[model samples]
Target: MSHIFPRHSAQSYPVAVGGEGCYLIDDTGKRYLDGSGGAAVSCLGHGDPDVTEAIKAQLDQLAFAHTGFFTSAPAEALADLLVEHAPDGLDRVYLVSGGSEAAEAAIKLARQYWVEKGAPSRSRLIARRQSYHGNTIGALSAGGNEWRRAQFGPLLLNVSHIAPCYEYRLREAGESAEAYGLRAANALEEEILRLGPDTVMAFMAEPVVGATAGAVTAAPGYFKRIREICDTYGVLLILDEVMCGMGRTGSLFACEQDGVAPDIVCIAKGLGAGYQPIGAMLCTAQIYDVIAAGSGFFQHGHTYLGHPAAAAGGLAVVSAILQRGLLPRVQEKGDALHARLMEQFKQHPNIGDIRGRGLFRGIEIVEDRESKAPFDPSRRIAANIKKAAFEAGLICYPMSGTIDGKHGDHVLLAPPFIISDDQLDELTDKLSQALNAVI
Candidate 1:
């Protein structure tokens, strides 16, 4: 009976009428705890007063201002704050409406940067398998998630994919973490050489792989090696932090934990905490300078590139996170949540892995703990778990195709930064019950 088209056509969904703190209320007055923050977007939880106020103030003053003619205060201020805290050498910001836009912009910018630097042949992009950048054609092309790219393969640009730094599945026995990391990182070097290094424009990756792999973090020295590989080939390194950034992983930027800096970074999702749609692509001074000196303008734009309302929401969210010291709080809560999961599920025969950083954690479900074999994709275990959890008045992010965009299942937990210990306990209890019922 609903006119609005939903993601899944056949399934009936509850009407989300309102939100308060970490809970969403349906029209029938049922309350569901937002355990995954609606795909890890709502970091400050729902109905935050500060973010609400900021949006209201922006609307009162001005709502939309096209970026072609002018830039609003909120947009300027947000860019300044982001640049100030960004990794070394990244001195510019390009705002967009969402994660896919930001990722697309990064790709275009990388291409243009090389062109401006007189390397027009550098057009190829190399990303890791089992990685996801975004859903748009360009971003989707950059991503290695096979299922998403399968039907749209012809529309996507030609991009090469290498092995992901997935230690759990790819690491060989008798191999040290560092050794496996080096071996995995070497894949990029091999790909670059095979592609003819000069023809490669960039190497893109998620510091901690999100959706496609379920909050998978890179091995200890993996990124350091990636940085070296990019530098060796003069290839730009673009880190897609749309899902893992913005303090989801205990740090303001996930790359901080890896001890490596990328040439360009894309961030979204938690940037505006779901209050408004906002995403940004930040780049190093060198890349900016190349474009500035050559064309004086990056050849790209969208109508709602820097809407004042979205900028205000993002600025306020960042302000609230810093003012309330939520970054450190995420670390504390993340530790507690991990410990609770381990204590509860370590002996559970189907739980294969409990791993992640900060509030962003993933529980990989397997058929046999001894073999770490995934549940049959035909079982649709992740979908069943999600539906069961929602029916039980809980909202968790569960996804299938964890192994190769077709097999494996995982539940990604990215509770709000404001979540309390009690809520964490509730999340675990609901999740445990859901998994039990499904498996």
Candidate 2:
């Protein structure tokens, strides 16, 4: 009956009519709490006046500018602000419309940087398993989610997938977290050597694995070892922070907590919150210098790159995050949320694990807690849980194929940084109801 094309045609969809704070209102007036920040996008929650005002002001002043010949003030200012707050050596920003675009740009930039640097043989990419980069072609190829990549295998370029630093499932019995981290990181080295390091252009991963692995954080020292491996092999480190960055992880940049910075980093979602769709691929000065000194052009372009209004929204959103002191608040709320989850679900039959940092957390479901055995894929536990959550006026991210391409389930929760204590309790209560219904 609707002219609009939906994501899943077989399933009816809710028309989100309005949003305020951490709740999204449907046409029927059901207010669903944004438990996962709508795939971890809405950092400041919905309808923040500051961000909307910035967008309106930018549209009134300069609505459109073709970046092929011109650069706008908002774009420049946004880039400057991002670089100012970015990890050391990450000195440039490439603005795009969303997460996929950012990932695509990062991939191309990494390859192009090598080409310009006279290392054109560096064409292969290495990423960790159970990671989700973006949906675009290049990004998809770089991502290691087998389920997402299966149908597109023929079209996808070859990429090496090393074992992810997922400690809960991957760590051996009696292994310390720190030791397990180093072992997990060494997988990259093994793959790089197997493929020949010079043939590899970049090693991409999320600081905290999102969507596919359900907010899995790396073991301690995992990324530090990863950084060292990249440096050793002359490979570029590309951190995909699409879902976990922008104060979602109690830090402006998720990599900040890891105490390491990547050569190129992709960020989106929370950057513009839900105010505007904007994402950026940030790189070090060295990478930028190599291309600038060689070709003077990066040889990549998107018509919507650096659109003024989007940049304005991103600028305003980030400004509010910093100026209003939301970073520390995320940390506080995150700790509270984590503690509450542990208190409530530590002994839950279906709740196997509760893990993550800041407001981003994951509750892995299991058939047996002692075995960490996942519910059968045919059971569709994740899908049913989602339906139950939605019906109960809760909006959380529940995903299948959490352990591999088809074995596990997890509910990822990343609420707005501004969520209050009462809202959080509501989230937990609703989630419990959903679990009770399905699990």
lDDT of 2 by residue, 1-439 (tens): 9998888889999888999989899999889899999999988888898899999999999988989989999999999999999999999999999999999999999999999989899999999889999988899998888999999999997888988888889999999999999999999999999999889999999999899988899999999999999999999999999999999998899999999989999999999897888999999999999988998998888899999999999999999999999999999999999988998899999898999999999999999999999999999999999999999999999999999878999999999999999998999998999999897
lDDT scores in order: 0.94, 0.93
lDDT of 1 by residue, 1-439 (tens): 6898898899888788999999999999999999999999999999999899999999999999889999999999999999888888889989998999999999999999989999999999999899999998999999999989999988999999999999889999999999999999999999999999999999999999988888899987999999999998899999999999999999889999999989999999999999999999999999999998998999999999989999999999998888899999999999999998998798999999999999999999999988889988999999999999998988999988998899999999999999988998999999999999999
RMSD of 2: 0.8
Q: Which stretches of candidate 2 lie over 4 Å from their true place?
A: none
The model with the greatest lDDT is 1
TM-score of 2: 0.99
How many residue pairs clash (N, CA or C atoms closer than 3 angstroms) in each of the candidate models, in the order given? 0, 0
